[model samples]
Target: MKKILLLLTLAICSWSVLHAQDDTFKKYRENAAGKLKKAENDTTNRLWKKGATLSLTVNQGSLTNWAAGGDKFSLSIAGAFSGFANYRKDRHRWDNTMELAYGYVNTTSLGGRKSDDRIDLTSKYGYQIGKSLYASALMNLRTQMANGYLYTDTSDIFVSKFFAPAYLILSPGLDYIPNDEFSLFVSPITARWVFVLDDSLANVGSYGVDTGKHVNTEYGAYLTANWNKKVTENIVFKSRLDLFSNYKHNPKNIDVYWTNMLTMKVNKYLSANVSLDMIYDDDIRVFENKNTGVLGPRLQIKQVIGVGFTAVF
Candidate 1:
């Protein structure tokens, strides 16, 4: 009987030990699963990001008596806004950006004139295919916010206005993004649409649209390269180059747009900015000389420098 009791006791102890080990393993597994879920949620939340920067610059000068033959009274004001939103989830990514700028200058000799105007928006969606490479589709829109004019001694000729020369481009391409500082995109098939909403401008066949037509379409190949880098702790540089070739007409005459900017930050609220822009389009004509009455395509260039209040968020 004692031997049988000892055997029963040993069996009972074995059962209890096995039960305890099972419970411990179950709790450990549950804890590990909870931690994994929390980590996944945190990663998902970090996939989306957004930021923006806004700047305003103002300058004024007055002279009671000046020997340099400059404007007696002069004032200039400029403002710019740039913003971006980006998302990444697994192999998919989306990026959107908007940029706006406007400037005005007034002097005793020139009166009030617009010195700069721009509105640009871009959105790109991409799926990763290889190392640092993606299959992407991009949409871009460019236009002006206000009336643009050519200043002359006698009169200011109305040249362009809001929506009068809006451009929309759509492309599906391959993007090569080696790092955060540079990217290149190329598309063999691209579509571009030009809109001249103003009745007068459409009637004059402005911006490559047919006479009296409000819209023009073209099939082309597009290429764009972008670079953004911090040259120093307080300085940044950004540049972009865009090229397009129409497959249907004048393919040899490619359109080009190049922009560059340098920014030096003084603090969280102050900065200095310099920008240069160049554009060339065969369809746009410029008057070379009024006396000769010659009109032809020409390269356009603009530069701006300013020190101003800036905010980034």
Candidate 2:
């Protein structure tokens, strides 16, 4: 009888041990699955930290005669496209963008002329300074065909040759974000150096009789305000205001340019946009006469309407 009791006790202990082991194995499996799910969720969350967009537009406009040298009525048709991609990991940020544009213009008096094509590349590195502030360093490079005109009293003349002018700008600035959709950026002071590929053009008579290659160093300030609001789930309104000034240089070279853009979604792939740009340049004549003899104070207003499509993968 004692032997029988001892065998039964042993059997019960064995069964309990087996059940405990099974429970432990099940718990471990569940824990592993939970960890895997959390990891996947973390990865998906990181995706929102990175974003990109591409935009293309065809624009047409006219330049009305207002300067000492220019056409009475000029028509311009151009196509421009730009793209940006950026990524942020925790407190470190990196971004890059590129733009390309080309166009053709016809003046009633000057005949038909092809526009200069251009390419611009920019990159930035940033560090989070606080909850709403960031310190960033930026580098921008631009190259473009020189397709300007020279105006004589008798006729409008196009440039006979093409030159590529490139420049580099390096700036370190602080950005302020008041909220998710609105922010203000101010670069209180910065140094800008403009590059001219060929000193030969500086000696060209078209720019000015006294035009020569001069190293231009300027102390400038830039401020920008951005606002974005969603009217609906698919419709959005965006506005930007930019102001720039060269305090230590010629006051006639200061400029302020602003634009307002509205975008409406027609579908998942198509959108409509209307943009208006106002430019006030103290030296508009300088840009116009960069390679010409015509000179005067000039003002410009530009309006554009277009449709665009985007695809996401």
Candidate 3:
């Protein structure tokens, strides 16, 4: 009877030890699962982000009896607004941006004139097809917020007004995005429309539209390249290039739009910036001097430099 009792005690002890080990393993698995869930939540928030920045630049000059003859009692104000929304998660991405800017200058010789005006919005959606290639669709709009004029000694020639020469583009393309700083997209088919909402500008056909027509539509092949990088500790550089070739018209003659912006940060709230914009459109006719120059396509360029108060998010 004592031998049988000893055997029973050993069996009970072995069962108890096995039950305790299983309970410990269950608690460890639960802790590991909780940590993994928290990590995943953090990653999701990092993938989706939103940001905005506003900058205002001002320039003023006062001359009581200055010798070096400049524009006496001059004042200029420029403002820029930029916002962005970006998302990337598991082979899907959506990127959106909006930019608005306006500037005015008043001087003794020039009187009051607009130095800059622009409104731009873009949205791009992509689904990854390969490691670095994506099927994408992009929509973009470019326009002005206010009237624009060219100043001369004789008169101020009305050049552009709100929606007078607005451009809208929709493209379905293949995007190559190797990293966050650079992107390239090419579309064999694209739809572009030029709208001249202002009646006066439409009558004169200012920018590539037919005379008295309100809208011009074209189908084309489109390509765009974008790059942005921090060149130095305090300097940032960004550039974008766009090309389009109309299928119905002269396909060899392509339209080009290129822009570059450089920023140097002095502090958290102060910065200096330089911008360059260039455009070439075969349908738009520009003449430097009508009396001595031929009427044809001319490359258009604009440049700006300023120091300003800037806020970024």
Candidate 4:
């Protein structure tokens, strides 16, 4: 009788413990479900849609004790950011974007150099005026954040500095926005400002500014065309083209800026990207060889590729 009573007590304890665990699991499931439903409700009621993503990439190569010769340790780092805020309600829309990227590379032969640099911001507001036309006001700013150099045998020479060659444009225009992916804006009245904020660059009249002047102002007619599309389940493409004709100067010489990007998503946080950029400004002069004395307008082109990390919300 004593042994039987002891066995019954053990069975009762085990059953009680199992019942407690089952209750705890159900409680956790209910809590999770409630939170998910709340999140869905908040998303459905939110007025503004916004998101941001940042990515970092690093590359390194080292040479240790080896028979053959190789480069001394090389290193490179790159960071990129992209974000957007869009507000839409009742035939009104305001769209904004910010894009920034910078990169640096170091090698035994060249020491250190800026491999890539960019800063671009855009804000456009529109009100519906027709089936596909909208009255719009747009502002754009473009610049770089680091010192650019002209590398030569003697040494490196400073060609650019932070905000030393900034471009700011403002225009009230008409936009033809046929769909979510494309927009064409035309403005007959536009004001453009070119700033050389660095003292050294301003004194030397770099980036088309006159010697001893810190800023150059121009009145112009401007047009910008942009397109963004998803090519496949994992691939996306984006492109922008800018054209500006100065009304006070040589109007026929239009300044052109074009940029393109293609991104392939591997997952929610991993991606591969490629970018191309080109710029042509009539006033800005560039020398192919730094040691040479002459200067002329040079068409600039840059290309970049790397695997990246991304996040959005």
Error of 4 at 280 (Å): 1.0
Candidate 1 lDDT tens digits, 6-63: 9999999999999999999999999999999999988977898889999999999998
Better by lDDT, candidate 2 or 1: 1
Candidate that would win on lDDT: 1
Cα displacement (Å) at residue 191, model 3: 0.5
TM-score for each predicted model, relative to the true structure:
0.87, 0.62, 0.85, 0.82
In model 3, the runs with Cα more than 4 Å from the true position are: 1-44, 290-294
Q: List the residue pairs that clash in candidate 1.
A: none
**Candidate 2 per-residue C-alpha lDDT over 125-211 given as tens digits, one digit per residue, 9 for 90 to 100:** 778899988897766665565465555668655532333234455667887766668866678676655444345554553222235
lDDT of 1 at 59: 99
Which pairs clash inside model 3? none
lDDT of 1 at 271: 99
Error of 3 at 103 (Å): 1.1
Model 2, residue 123: C-alpha shift (Å):
3.7
Q: Give Cα distance to truth, residue 295, candidate 4, Å.
A: 1.1
lDDT of 3 by residue, 172-264 (tens): 999999988999999999999999898888898877788999899999999999999999999999999999999988899999999899999
Name the lDDT of candidate 1.
Answer: 0.93
For candidate 2, the 10 contiguous residues with the lowest summed lDDT are 158-167
TM-score of 2: 0.62
- lDDT at 121, model 3: 95
Q: Candidate 2, which segments miss by more than 4 Å at Cα?
A: 1-80, 103-122, 141-167, 198-200, 204-210, 251-253, 281-294, 308-313
The CA lDDT at 61 in model 1 is 96
